[model samples]
Target: MNFREFASKNVHRNIKAYFAYFFSSSISAALLFSFTMIIFHPDFVKVDLPQYLIKALNVTTIIAYLFLFFFVFYSVSVFLKSRYKEFGILYIIGASRKQIQRMISIENIIISSVSAIVGIIVGIVFSKILLAASGKLLGFNALGFYMPVKAMIITFVAFVMIGIVISIFCSFIIKEDMVLKLLKGTKKPKAEPKASSILVIICITLLTVGYYLSITSSTKTLTNRIIPVTLMVVVATYLLFSQLSVFTIKLLKKNRNLYMKKTTVLWVSNLLYKIKDNTRMFFLITITSTIALTSIGSVYAYWRDKEDQINRDFPQAFFLSDIYDNKSKVDSKAGFIEDSLINQGIEYNKINEELKFVIPDGGKDNVVIIKEDIYKKLISMLSLNANFSKEDESLISNHKVKNIVLDNVEIEVVLKSDRGLIPTFYGEVYVVKNDIYEKITGVRGYFGAFNVENYQDTLNICNDYYNNFGYEKEDKYHNNLLKSRILRSTKVAYGVILFSAIFIGLIFFVTTGSFLYNKCYMDVIEDKKKYRQLNKIGLTYKEIKRVLNIEIGVLFLLPYIIAVIHFFFAISSLRYAFKLEIKVAAFRVIVIMLIAQIIYFLIIKKRYLLEIKKSLI
Candidate 1:
């Protein structure tokens, strides 16, 4: 047979080993293609996305492509390693190295061609849904669907090139002298896997330190320590699976009652080698899954709490101020805004307060002072309760100071309110009696607060007022419309991040599952042989099945459970760092991930059982 035909037959015979690799490659291609289609869409420009957002999409697409290359490369290495015995037999039959290289090239080309074609088709099918979701999340007009010829060409070419490059690189990995080693393969008996006591202790220490730092570090320190903490956790996790797990398993083996029970002896004896062999795979899976969970959870938390954040920063729906002494300008702008609201048929309450900016005695910073009457009116307008009975005392709003000396008048701060009476731009407001305000000589300004029902729905009117009357020059008349716009834009940006995180997290999850499946597939021949021998020794089929269940369950769930533990600490640290109530969002993500893992486990377990059953027949 020709080399092409031989390669095709070999691929067909090893389809099980190739399936996960093909599936993951196709998925990676589809993700890239779908993202490219969004970037290249005809209406994308019309969406008016900010330049930074556009750049972010482009950068994310590039990163995805890079990830795809590494993912494909790793899968190819795994696939090649699993077929060492086959390669050895070909060597024994006198197949030249160059000829084997050509065979591998032909096989990869076939797989790549089919995967790219199928992936592009699937991407096209899902492009419209992705566009609609993006548009909705970004608050843009619905994106129209068109043939993505440029995207298709790019994705197909990229996938095929990646396959070819990786295949050639993998070909060079096999050496001439490795034929005997390849032939031995898994048949070479292994001594008991050993763990270094020092390494195990180091692993435990690193993990403890990492977890402690993650949980205890405040937001201020988190940024500086994040890199070191991540490195620590990553190295610790690697050693955790490589050394700690083996050590723990050995300790379990020493318990004769637990280790010697039922089919435990069979599975336990086999599990030691399995865990040792799969250490790196477990490490990769755990880290990848932890990243997926934490990213999705953190971003979702930000998106979920966006409204509360806006409300906290901006208490008033509309605030217009003239930092200069221009009462006429402030009144005119305030009247114009009130008229605009009336024109839009929106109900609102307005508070006009005169604020005096004075550098407090013995302090360099300016403190705003307003009268008691205005303070009462402002709090009532905002549905806040405050009592200021003494003229000598003051109420501090959104400030931590307990006393203020304005123009040498020592005013004790009787109450401190967290809620801002106005937008936070005018800092450190003190509510004093009219006598106290009149006694201070300082630069004065007019502040207007407009509280409207369903104010969020008034973006159009607010934008119109700003367009017609808002001044660009600073220190003249500043309005809160810009702040409102920023808040809306912030929400959109967070939505974009949250959506992207979910998408990338799913890709990571799927890749990790595929990795596990490939690992299981690699051991199928060995498992079948081992189980057949156990069956000859009067081990019943039921017992063998039980052992398989135990082994498969540990293989599939151990990494996931560890990843969840890692994720919990990560999310907890994020919560403390950001001071966000992210428990609900984190919990939701965990539940969804758990369900997906369970489904993946069931499917893989069934397939593995069928593969091993073939040996019995």
Candidate 2:
């Protein structure tokens, strides 16, 4: 037969083995194509989004393309490794090394071409839905659907390049291995694995240190420690599976009761060897699971914290400062704003506040002082029932630090006032009694905080007010406009990240599942001998099934459990660092991931038993 025909037949015959690689490559290409389509979408460009965000999307698309190359290449390599025996058999049957290489290359080309075509088609169909959703999130009035020929061409070319790269890579891999090693494949038996106490200790130390750093680092200090902490955690995670797990399992094996039990002995013996051999793959699974959890959790947390974030960044819809000194100006501006709001039939509530800045001897600067009565009035107006005694000092700050506190108040100012007077020292707001505030010789100002029924409508009124009389006081709608602008940018950024995280997470998940499946399949050849021996010793099919269940279950769940532990600490750090209320988001991420993992485990288990049962029979 011609090599092309042989390659085609081989590919068809080994469809199950190729399923994971093909699906992953195709899905990755689809994601890349979809994202590229967004970047070059004709309607997307016509939207009123920022150029920088568009630029960011372009950069992300490029990065995604680069990432997919490595990802697809890795899956292909794994798939090739699984078929080493096939190549060896061909060689033994008088097929030259070049023939084998050619066959593999032809197979890759055919598979990749088909996968890429399917991927691009799927991506094109989904890009419209993605763009429509993104448009709504970005506050775009319209992002009409149209085919992006440029994006399609880019995706097609990039994936084709990847296919070529994989083909070349496979050739090199084949050339490096001896014919005997290829024939033996991954089934070369070795002595039982021994745990390294030093490695176990190092793993424990690293994990402890990493978890400590993650949990204890404050919001301000986290960024500095993040890299080192991540490195330590990654190294530790590898060792945890590779060394610590082996050590612990060995210790458990020493227990006669658990070790000598019917199927436990069968599974445990297999598991001991399997765990040692599969450590690296287990580490990969754990890391990817952690990535999926953390990425999805972070995205959900940001979305969940949106309201608080808005309030923290933009305290009020409109803020009028230093209006006390000029009553006429204050009356004019406030009257115009209220009149405009009334004219537009927009509902809003207004608060009159007297703000004072105290020049403190030490601590922080930019501190605003307000009378306790005003504080109580604000609390009452907000329907908050918190009590503040005359002696107790209340602070309003975005950050929570030592010597800092929070009240239900939001203050904004710097050392320099609009009148160009520089305060000697200012810090956080101090809600003090009227007597203490009066004694401080503080710089006083009129502060008006406006809350609108409709944020956009109120922002429009504030903008109109700014255009009329409050232009000099840019602080009013600076926060509003800044808030709107930031929200738009954040929606886009988070939307992109969320979609990417979910897509990539699913890829990693599927890839990991496939890894486990491939490992099981590889073990099948070796396991046949072991099962034959067990059957001679009267090991029943029921017992064999139980062993297979335990084996696959442990292999599947160990990494997942470790990853969940890692995510726990990670989300904890995010909570403390960003001061985010992430319980709901965390809960959602955990539940969804658990459901997905269960489904994947069930599928793998069913297939694995079917394969192993053949050996048992």
Candidate 3:
């Protein structure tokens, strides 16, 4: 009679509602918590570069919201279907429409709120996990994980708001007549005619063209990206699902053995029915699987690239450079370093560390503005452009123009040798090469590069350097952001993305795969009558399993094959999105994805077969 009693009853009635809540809240919390730790990283405070990266990472919140929103929205629909009959009951009970609406509203709001709270707690836990993971990744001591209460509030507020909004919208469904509907199941909508074969072929052709553009695109120039590929994949994915399911069913109908069998006709009919029955699920599976494969693969690729890059940054065993904030100090530091190297029993075969200035040539598309201080430091550590131009002066300015970067910048430099000097000239600066040091801008800077004899020894030297000059030891944070590309960086960037995607994809494949599994198992469950009738005539369990296996294989493998092919071309279409130069990257990406795909298929297939065996038993 009262609100509390009504609420308790509603809660008891809807278990799926709770699951929806749990999934939504948990996913949201995880992303928010992880992001919070990433944004104001304690480790990054000392490392100036990470601080900037942290800032950029925060901007990706929109992406998280989009994902969570889809998850929660779709879950509500699924939950509703399970409880639709209950609404019919309420309608039959002679409850006033207003009363029914009130009850449903209370139920939805309560479920959403409870779910959001649980999600935040789970998120808090996941935050700790992510922080710990990041610590290992950066090779830093792990801090005791703690939630940013403020972040908790923000996540809590946002998801709660989303829940309330979704619930309020859901409440309106109560207005539908519920009583008479209780006796009859919801009416099935009439199916549309099958897509025209010619139209389907035309679409396939167009999708092929889209894919061709992606694979052929030069990735080096940022001319390509994920957008086109993603779109192409989506369109192709849906079309393939529609076309393949229909065409295959029609093909099987033509086979005498397949069509003439008693229940085989029914099974075939069911397959055609499901092609219509599972349209929404098909769309979801297609997209989710594609994203998953790409995401998991991308993360590993990105990480590997970073590792390769760090290794390539220094190839020798041991090397050191001077520490200074200006040209004069830099020259003196070079002397200090040279003396230290000699005193330390180190031999240098060639000039290991060279200095140059990276000046920004501003442009619209550039996301990373490689500033003077950062570039100077990078160039000093490795051999860079010797030419300087008036553009190089922009490095001294607070806002450097990135468009001009790698453009018309003049450089001047001199090469020092025991017997002679070689001078090089560029736009503005004159070369004073052939000395103990190379000067860039004659300004105070802490940027330099090095190559060493051995990696481990160099690591130790770096440790010592960090002990002296690392984040905590440094008095202030420098805002120099320099970006570099590793040959494998693209793969790595996509690897982590691929990992999350695959994690979700695997979940989706398995979950939806269940429906297919169930269709096979349903025969076993309902076989008593059908078998009794058949036995009166003639049949065996072995024959039954054989027939069932064929049916299940067609059902399971058909969409999967279509999805796999769609994903391949879809991935190819991504060429323009990533601006990937070196088409070889796509090949490498493909190989990695294939290896992972095999691994994933093996796992899911094992689960599917287990279900089949369980059903047969």
lDDT of each: 0.82, 0.70, 0.48
Q: What tens-digit string does per-residue lDDT give for candidate 3 at 568-588? A: 555543434442232444456
- Model 1 Cα shift for residue 288 (angstroms): 1.5
Clashes of each: 0, 6, 68
How does each model score on TM-score? Answer: 0.89, 0.83, 0.61
Among all candidates shown, the one with the greatest TM-score: 1
Q: Flag regions of model 3 displaced more than 4 Å.
A: 1-4, 16-52, 113-131, 147-159, 177-184, 189-193, 210-217, 261-263, 310-333, 336-450, 455-617
- Top model by lDDT, which number? 1
Candidate 3 accuracy as TM-score: 0.61
- Looking at candidate 1, the ten consecutive residues that score lowest on lDDT are 475-484
* Pairs in clash, predicted candidate 2: 365-426, 365-427, 366-426, 366-427, 367-426, 367-427
Model 2 segments more than 4 A misplaced:
38-63, 89-97, 124-145, 148-151, 320-336, 351-365, 371-427, 433-448, 454-493, 615-617
| Tens-digit lDDT string for candidate 2 (1-617) | 87689899989998987776777678777876666676566765665556666665656566566656666666667777877787788777888878877887888887777778888898777766877775664445446777678767876777778878878887877753577988888676589888899999999999999999998878678999889988999999988878998898899899999899767877877788888888888998899889888987887788657656765555445555663576455555667766876798877666766776544554344456677678766555444554566354444432322242223222222111111011112234555567656666555667555556446545455456556654353442121232343455566666656655665676567667767766766676677777778888998878887887788888888899999999989888988886788888888888888888888789877876777677766
How close to the true structure is residue 419 of candidate 1, measured as C-alpha lDDT?
Answer: 88
